[model samples]
Target: MSEQNKTWCPNIEFNETDEELILKAELPGVKIEDLIINAQTRFVSISGICNPDKSTDEKEVIPSQFNYGQIKCNTPLPVAIQPEKTRAEFIDGVLTISMPKLRVASAVNF
Candidate 1:
């Protein structure tokens, strides 16, 4: 496939729980080394490369539906999170990211 044909962005899902925020991204055929994950206080971003199939011939391809090449997904959090405590894991073509919600300190009246 050509460079223009090989570029696509993956789809991501974001959810929030009582204690943490969760992210799930579809990243089939992507390797851990090719992935980059970035976390901030209120946002998280992920980029990765999905290698194209080398065994298939250009003529043999009928309908192309797969997403290949560099892919990126970014989303802003609904609430502030602790970026330092963020964690990510990739399993079975899915990437899962978990970030702990920041604890708000209450002011005490004198």
Candidate 2:
């Protein structure tokens, strides 16, 4: 888990449906307000920082091992997507993004 802490959370999954691609990102302890979602073409990126712990605010003296800051990371998707049609939702610190795939015309030889 420490190695994962060095970067963003490692837990993620991708699912493809007839009309859309589903992406789920795990972000524990992160507030919904802090998250930012941006999508373009086939790539989507989300970055955000977890809110500071409430206990820290009451302390008169600072701790030596406490680490708090704006934690942000970006990840790329495997396929192209329509950014404007994309939708996102967050629940229990997990972010789920849905992107509709672009349509392509194919030719058939008779």
Candidate 3:
């Protein structure tokens, strides 16, 4: 944890208009294939491995803020979500996920 980014909380947001729950994670220099997404009946989990020294595969001789280890976060879903109806993309160093919220029907009489 750095002095500047010591107050960062990675979580998902529910966009009512979009009718989907979006999850945003700040993972600098994370590869697409290194990330893993798993969705269950009422929850979703995302995790990725970060290797700051992967490009060279050389021995690391120093430690710094850039050194980020495995990151994984499991978020509880508000509504049932289709496991197959999920999309993820990586841009720069952030990961964006869009999940379509499941719809539950209710019977009402007028």
Candidate 4:
């Protein structure tokens, strides 16, 4: 199939703590340079491209279920976050993003 015609979705997990929110995405065979991440106060978006291995050999056709090409995911945060403080890392085909929650002061009555 043509590279432009293929599309795939990566598995993702989102979690939140009292101090921060965490997002994890499983992307096999995807390079770090091909990833793009955008974070806002209330949402996060991830996009990337995964290319299939190129081979120049004559072989018989076989049935396979591997996905390639563009991938995109947009998820809303459970709470307000500090997008400026967001941090991310990619390891072993897995991406982990950590975002600190925006702290709001509580009202006090004397």
Candidate 5:
């Protein structure tokens, strides 16, 4: 399939702490160099490819369980964030992203 033709959505998990929002995505067999992340103040986008296993001998395939293809995940931030300081890490077939929550300014009346 062409690079632009094959696409899929990977599953994701979200967590929030007092300081930041954490996003974890399941991406088995995907390389770090193949990933592209785009973060905004209220949104984040992750895209990559999970290439099919070529090492396994081509037998009469009965059934395939793993979803292998172009994977993409787009998630909305619970609160505004400083996208410039966002951090992403890929380890053990999982992608974790931490986004610092923007602090709200308080108002005072005399």
Candidate 6:
């Protein structure tokens, strides 16, 4: 397939703390403005576009293994989360998402 028609899925890592769940995705060559992130109580979806190298002419370019095209990833969260409180950050080609876990109140006996 052509570079622009290819689809790539970024590598993702998941971690959890006592109060929150963390998701990290490696998205090299993807710009912040091109990213789209959405989270629900049990799932998170990420999509973006990575533009192909434009500085070099097609005739002068060497065959490369780099991926450039549409990026997509849809993963289920390990635990229930507070979707309204989810936070995300992108830095150094990495995207980090912090989701606070849903807390259930225990029954109290009088």
For candidate 2, which ten residues in a row score worst on lDDT?
1-10
lDDT per residue as tens, model 4, 4-95: 55766688888888898999999878899999999999999988898777576845277446667888888888898999999999999999
Query: Residues 17-90, candidate 6, lDDT per residue (tens digit)?
Result: 99999999999888999999999999999998998766665663576677788988899998999999999999
Candidate 5 segments whose C-alpha is farther than 4 A from its true place: 1-5
lDDT of each: 0.84, 0.71, 0.68, 0.87, 0.85, 0.91
Query: Number of clashes in every candidate structure?
Result: 0, 3, 0, 0, 0, 0
**TM-score for each prediction?**
0.85, 0.71, 0.69, 0.86, 0.87, 0.89
Candidate closest to the true structure, highest TM-score: 6
lDDT winner among the candidates? 6
lDDT of 1 by residue, 74-101 (tens): 7888889999999999999999999999
Tens digit of lDDT per residue, candidate 5, span 1-110?
A: 54345688778988999999999998887889999999999999998777766667676366556777777778888799889999999999899999999888899899
Ranking by lDDT: 6, 4, 5, 1, 2, 3
Whichever of 4 and 6 has more lDDT, that candidate is 6
Worst 10 residues of 6 by lDDT: 52-61
Q: Residue 18 CA error for candidate 3 (Å)?
A: 4.7
State the lDDT at 30 in candidate 5.
Answer: 85
Clash pairs for candidate 6: none
TM-score of 3: 0.69
Steric clash pairs (candidate 4) = none
Candidate 5 lDDT for residue 76? 84
Query: Candidate 2 on 1-110: residue-level lDDT in tens?
Result: 33224334326789999889898887776777877888888577776665455685586365424323445555676777888999999998678899999777799899
Candidate 2 clashing pairs, residues 3+ apart or interchain: 41-81, 42-80, 42-81
Give the residue spans of candidate 2 off by over 4 A: 1-10, 57-68, 108-110
Candidate 3 stretches greater than 4 Å from native = 1-18, 54-63, 108-110
Q: After superposing candidate 4, which stretches have Cα over 4 Å from the reference?
A: 1-4, 58-60
